[model samples]
Target: MNISIHSFTLKLRDPFRISYESRNEQEALVIQLSDTNQQGQTVTGLGESTANNYYQVSIERMQKEVALVRERIEEYSLANEVLNAGQVGTPGHLWQQLQPELQHSSFTLCAIDVAAHDLYGKKVGQPLYKLWGLNPADAPTTNYTLGIDSIEVMIRKMQAKPWPIYKIKLGTPEDLAIVRELRKHTNAVFRVDANCAWGVDETIENAQELKKLGVEFIEQPLKADNWDGMKEVYQHSALPLIADESCIVEDDVAKCAGHFHGINIKLTKCGGITPARRMIREAQRHNMKVMIGCMTESTIGISAIAHLSPLLNYVDMDGALLLAEDIATGVTITTDGVHFPDENGTGVQLLTPSPTSLV
Candidate 1:
């Protein structure tokens, strides 16, 4: 068993603006795992923030982690064991044991899961969705995002696209005006993402105002750590609230269960697919809706989530739509919704490595 990593920069097709910031490119770590038996797999892991935010693991640091994990794989013969195990424990229990090794190494854990799924899917000659018992024919329609911009620019952008669903970014009082203007241009179902910009009181006020704009929901309005405040806002506001940052980890779901009407599950934030599935199940049991989302990643990551979108209430897997030039190939995005590959594995095709710069 062996593991290796390469750092790549993905240039966005257009500058992506959010409530927090904007970016022209994204830095990502591509981890490749292989065994002596000729089986090889790859997973692209994105850092927390975009290129300008400095939230990424330094290239040097990432390389070192890859080396360490590669050594561990060899020492434990993990590749052989993972491949040969007739029936592994439930994804949750196996993930629990791997969590210690994964602590402080989110990128590695993400890579490991991707690799494991790729290997497993290949071994069984099935696509990832089938392995998880998900049927692509049941996927829900996905929403495309309209990043923070002047009202005029937003209106123009909306007028040019035929997408039936759109998510607007809002973080300031000025955003109220933008939302109003957007409502006039398109009757598409709308969602607002505050990105934790508002406090409990402000969220309540803004959500009230947004309700008149025909919003379908408001996402992450209050701070992630302020569960009580989120509850206050959720209870007071007429519009539904979806938890984003607040539901990054499994336990975070429990904290926001009673407060949020739904959750935005991102593979990157939750570590990987294993925990993400658990979060979705838990949210379902609590009667909370699910919105599977993604960071600013290539089709590789978005395609991974597209396989599970059918099982959720909402879908926001539009990160690939924002990329300037993606590695290209995987999921297909139409104005109606995202379409997955009919082939085995994730249906993702790894392109020749092309590295860009964050600076």
Candidate 2:
């Protein structure tokens, strides 16, 4: 098997603003796994992950980690002749073996894990959702995001797309004012994400104001490690709390059971579909709602998250929707929701090679 990595900077359609920062671009790494058979039939699988500075995974760090992971995979394939590209191992086995080395770099591991799943899905001639027996109707409607900006600017952004569901970024003094202002323009459902910027008392006050504005939920209002603060808000706030930075992996879900009403699972945060599926099940087992979210990625990464939409409660896999330019094709996003194409694997195809390379 041949493994290669490509790096690219995805330009955002608009400046994406969270409480922590704002950006017009994001860094991403694409991983491809390929092998040619005796008949000269070459099969290639692709996966991508965006590197987020907020998550502590920088572009340089992710690139270095990918190289290390690729070298390790090559060594394992050489040492174990039984593990071929076709019959490498179950997702569980593959992950268990690499967990120790890849544990700290979930974002990097996500790219490899997604690529492997793409390869296996293609070999089996089925999409991952179909393979997992998920129904298309069960997939939830996705929410388009509105970042922090002046009242006029933010309102203009909202009016441009006018998606049914909108995720509004908060944490500024105008957090409630933003919602109140948008409410005057449209009757769209709203979800607010504070990006872990408020204190417990402030979150309670904000939640009360948001609930009155008919905001659906509040996401990560307090800091990630502020368990006590989150619990305090969850105990009294009118809106349900959804964990983003607070819930990074499956284990985090267990710890966040009573503190948060729902958990936001991102492929970049949890590693890949394999672990993400596990996290969903775990969250469900704890009687918590599940949301599948994403970084500002391209079709390659966002499409990977879309495959698991059937298992999600609230879908925010609109990372690709925010891109000014996309290099892959597959899923289609509309005001209604996301629709997948009839293709094997993750239903994504790279239209062109990334022009950038790892320096």
Candidate 3:
């Protein structure tokens, strides 16, 4: 068993501004796991996790977390020669084994869990989506994000991309005004995300007005801990509400059941595909709409999100599309839709060789 780590500073085409924060550069940790499988094939799998100030996750912290378990990880993999051989030792089982060291940093846990799944898929010679029996044709169209900017600049972005759906970030006083103005230019479907910036009354009011402008849904209007407030808005708001920060892990799914109409699971937030699959199933059991989103990451993370699209009602995997340049090659998302590469394991190949170390 071998592990290699590399970090990159991903430059965005424009400064990505959500309600809580804005960033021009995103720091990402991409790791590769190599091991000879039971069939004696050397396979390497890729995984990614980005630094997020909102979540208080830093590259230094993730690196330390990985270092803490480095020896155990290698030893465990070596001892269990057929570690990921079959369902007996799945990604979920691996996640449990590493939980003690990585539990403090979901970002770190996500990277390893995703890499393990990618490795398993490659060992079996199948993509994760295909292995799960999902059809690419059933996947939903992903929406391109438009950060907060002047209405004129926003309109220009809309004109430039001309996508089928646009996720318009809102939190300013001129929120509806921006949407109304952008609506005049194109008939593209609009989805508004306040990023936990609106109040209960404000959310209800905006929902009614935004619904009239063809806005499909509202995402994380109030603060994540404001369940009392969300209850009132959920019942009164004209548009459906999707929870982002409110739903972090599998346990949060049931907690968000009555307050939110759906959930937007970020792979990094929920600790990758293994637990994310459980989160999706739990959300479905509660009869809630399920969505998967991405941060301003490279194709390594975005490609992992793409394979989960077939299980979602909505998708926000346009993270890589907003990049000025990408560091890896994987599933490609274009204006038309997502295109998977002709290879397996999220179809990711780093454009450059891994660095000696990211510390």
Candidate 4:
């Protein structure tokens, strides 16, 4: 594994606020795993994990973790090991091989895993979705996120980009007012994400009102750890609930089965696309709605999610759309839907040269 970590900052076009914090920019990290393919062409896989204040995952911490595993990673590249695409266990094998070290941060592991998937796809000369035997036509249209802001600003955001669906962030005394006001503008399908801000009673009440206003679902309304509250809300809430903060890993998929109407799998949070594929299958087995969301990352990360979209009921890969600028080129997501690049391996390429690549 010739691990090359590129660090950058992704600036948001608007200052995005959720329940936990507000930010104008996100610190981003891109992981590229390079190895020679059978044709003697140097191929690299791409993955991204951004700094998150809520999760306390910073670029420095991820870098340190990467440093710890550099030797083992390079050893694989030195052996010229060819990563096989279409095998679900490819990333799992990597996780086990890295062992005690890669476990330090899911963020670091996410970058490496994503890169490995991309590398594998490139090796086999196939896009990931095609390799997985998925049809792009089955993929759902992703919702554009309107982060928490003053009602006026939020409305402007909606006007700027009219989408088929909008995921509104809410965590305020005027939560209803915000949605009510935004609802007046467009007939777009609404999905509210409370970011674990409301209590059980508040969530139930809000769901009733939101359902009336055409809200398709409510996401993470109560705190993540409030399983008891979730149970009550699950029983009584008018709108279907989707778990975000509550569902972090494959195990959480089972836990969220009865509690939430669905589960939202985030690659960055769950250690990238490898486990995410398993999580999606598990959620499907549970008959729960499956969704995959992206952190405020670049096309590299969002494209990773895009390839897996055929398996999801809903998708929130709008993270790259929220950015003022992206660090790379990969997928194109417009109001029409996500369009994959013709290139294989997530189809990602950095705009600038990597001066910080570590051998």
Sort by TM-score, best first. Answer: 3, 4, 2, 1
* Candidate 4 or 1, higher TM-score: 4
Give a tens-digit lDDT track for model 1, residues 1-359: 34555566788766668877887788766555443322544322222211224235555655565565555543432222323322443223434556676666655565556555554454455676876777787788888888887778888777876688999888866888898888887788999999988888888888788888889999998877887787678779989999997887788777777899989987765666777788898998899999888777677777777877878999888877877677747778888566776665566666775464222
Model 3, position 40: C-alpha lDDT score: 87
- Find the candidate with the highest lDDT and give its number: 3
True-vs-predicted CA distance for residue 26, candidate 1, Å = 0.9
Candidate 2's displacement at residue 203, Å, is 1.4
**Clashing pairs for predicted structure model 3, backbone only:** none
Error of 4 at 332 (Å): 0.9
Q: Give the per-residue lDDT of model 4 (tens digit) for 63-124.
A: 88888888877776322333453333365577656646766588888898888778877876
Please report the TM-score between candidate 1 and the true structure.
Answer: 0.87
- Candidate 3 lDDT at 148 equals 95
Q: Give the C-alpha miss distance for residue 263 in model 2, angstroms.
A: 0.3
| Candidate 3, residue 46: lDDT | 86
- Evaluated against the true structure, the overall lDDT of model 4 is 0.86
Task: Give residue 171's error in model 1 in angstroms.
Answer: 0.6
Screening candidate 1 with a backbone cut-off below 3 angstroms (N, C-alpha, C), the clashing residue pairs are 12-324, 13-323, 13-324
Summarize candidate 2's per-residue lDDT along 36-83 as a digit string, tens digits: 433456666788888887778877787888776675665443111223
RMSD of model 1 against the true structure: 3.8
Model 4 TM-score? Answer: 0.95
Worst 10 residues of 4 by lDDT: 78-87
Superposition TM-score, candidate 3 onto the true structure: 0.95
In model 2, pairs of residues that clash are: none
